[model samples]
Target: MKRENLLVLLAGICTGLAALALTMLGNPANMGFCIACFERDIAGAVGLHSAAKVQYVRPEIIGLVLGSAVTALIAGEWKARSGSSPALRFVLGAFAMIGALAFLGCPLRMVIRLGGGDLNAVVGLIGFALGIFIGTRFVRRGFTLQRSYPARRTDGAVLPIIMLGLLVLFVAAPAIFRLSTEGPGSKHAPFFLALAIALVIGALAQRSRLCMVGGLRDTMMFGDAHLLWGFAAIFVTVLVGNLILHKFSLGFGAQPVAHSSHLWNLLGMTLCGWACVLLGGCPLRQLILAGEGNGDCAVTVLGMIVGAALAHNFALAGNPDSVNEAGELVVGGISMAGKIAVLLGLAVVLAVSVFNSRLGAKKNG
Candidate 1:
């Protein structure tokens, strides 16, 4: 096996093990790492939204950015660049978050949910692939977001510096943050420990260039399974770990932090998958790129944070299935508003894809 592929496989193994460890140590079930969920929690903690139950500064996020930044610097791979449709990228980022929240997780978490045997994630996986397939069609037709230019080192360091401040606030000035007393936000592994694990995962991901969206996109576009190997390793590792730990529950209902709204699950992920393709990376990949001094990706990350805030504020996020006081299964899903938002997201992304494609530009010219 090539060294790069092996590194990716190792990264996947470590990621899966980290997720399992964090869960055992008190993070939400099948939620050892979720870029969307953690970012949403960070938004709430910083008063971006009023979601009381999901407010906290997740150290894993802080660690991921910092870890990647540090690793890039050490590897001499850090370079500052920006200016490729920043405004559009930000909007796309927002819509991506909106879609992911509508489905209750990002692509990474979707895979993790699958490892834990959630059948709903299987539905999400199908939709995600379909979305990627649609995006690839545009790519084959010469879809392009244009080129980015070189930037100042400080511009690239902005996100890392911000993450450092957040870490300080998380560790030193916790009183200023609105910590969740209950719900998923309240459930977490130890702060330093989670941070430490995430730092390692970030370093590994940076080295291996691990990305779930890239895995599917590359396979479709170039018949390359190089990136997919990492996710495959992750799935196998998590599946074994869950089974050994008795955390594997194969069913559609009663899963933690998930809904049985199969249609929304499919559509939401479809939107997320499509938007990420246009953005040129998944949420996790965006974070890693931002850390490596891509100012445009940093903007996208900021947009995702705000998008998460807006989701909760506007009731666009999905609700999980729950048992009611009457001892009956109460189905949980997105509201009409959320449904509209997802459909709107799809329309907006489609428009972006068309306008950005070379064929569309040529026809207009």
Candidate 2:
């Protein structure tokens, strides 16, 4: 097998193992390594949310950055660079996290949720695909971020070291950042187990360049199938694992930290989907790409942090019982605003794509 193919295979396996560990450790089945949810929980740990039950610094996230950094360094893949519409990317990142939180998970989680038999994930998945399609249209136009410039080596290393620092903090202040007393944080696999799984996944993912955005982008842009194959592999692995563990459950009421509002599910993931497209990668892809020295990805990571902070501060996030003021859990589903935002966002993305494409055509002509 070619080296790239081997790496992709390893990536699929690692992702599967991570998902399985998440289920075994007591997260919702097939919910292992949800980039969005885990990050939101981390946001809560630093007091981003008043939701006490959800607060805790997840080791997997910290491990992902450091692990990817380690792999990139060993493989000579690290490169420090910047200047890809930094401000726009940052906004996209922030909104992406918001959308993901709204939906209760990222693209990775959407797929994994389906693996666990949550039909709600199907809505989210469709929304995500639609958003990516819209973003792809933008790409077909001349909508392009400016090229990045090389940065100082230390600048490249700084973010990864900070991630390492977080790992140490997890060790020194385990009690302070103690796994949640209840809720998702409360139900984690052992620290070392989580760390090991995260490290392996991070490394493999870095090598494979696995990304949810890329999955759709490739299919639309070039009719490529390799990245899609990796996604399929992960879905298959998680599905089988859920079956084997008997953790698969059908139906949607009273699931942990998930709401029944189908509109919000679609809207939330749509936000995440659009933002991921604009920023050029999903949250996990952002993390791995950042480790490989893509400063734009790092900016998106910062956007996620800020977005988390804002969500908690503004009461945008939903608890297990209910949503915020503007976010009502109506009888049929989520409120009208939720549905409108998805439409509006898509409209804006489409307009941008059309405008940019016309400009590009003129320039070429």
lDDT of each: 0.92, 0.74
Worst 10 residues of 1 by lDDT: 356-365
TM-score computed on alpha carbons, candidate 2: 0.88
Error of 1 at 53 (Å): 0.8
> What tens digits encode model 1's per-residue C-alpha lDDT throughout 10-74?
99999999999999999999998899999999999999999999998998888888889999999
For model 2, what is the error of residue 45's alpha carbon versus the real structure, in angstroms, after optimal superposition? 1.6
Error of 2 at 83 (Å): 2.0
Across 27-77, the per-residue lDDT of candidate 2 in tens digits comes to 654568788777777877766566666677777887788789889989998
Candidate maximizing lDDT: 1
**Candidate 2: clashing pairs of residues:** none
Model 1 clashing-pair count: 0
Question: What lDDT score is found at residue 261 in candidate 2?
Answer: 74
The C-alpha RMSD in Å for every predicted model, in order, reads: 1.5, 4.0
Candidate 1 Cα errors over 4 Å, as ranges:
359-365
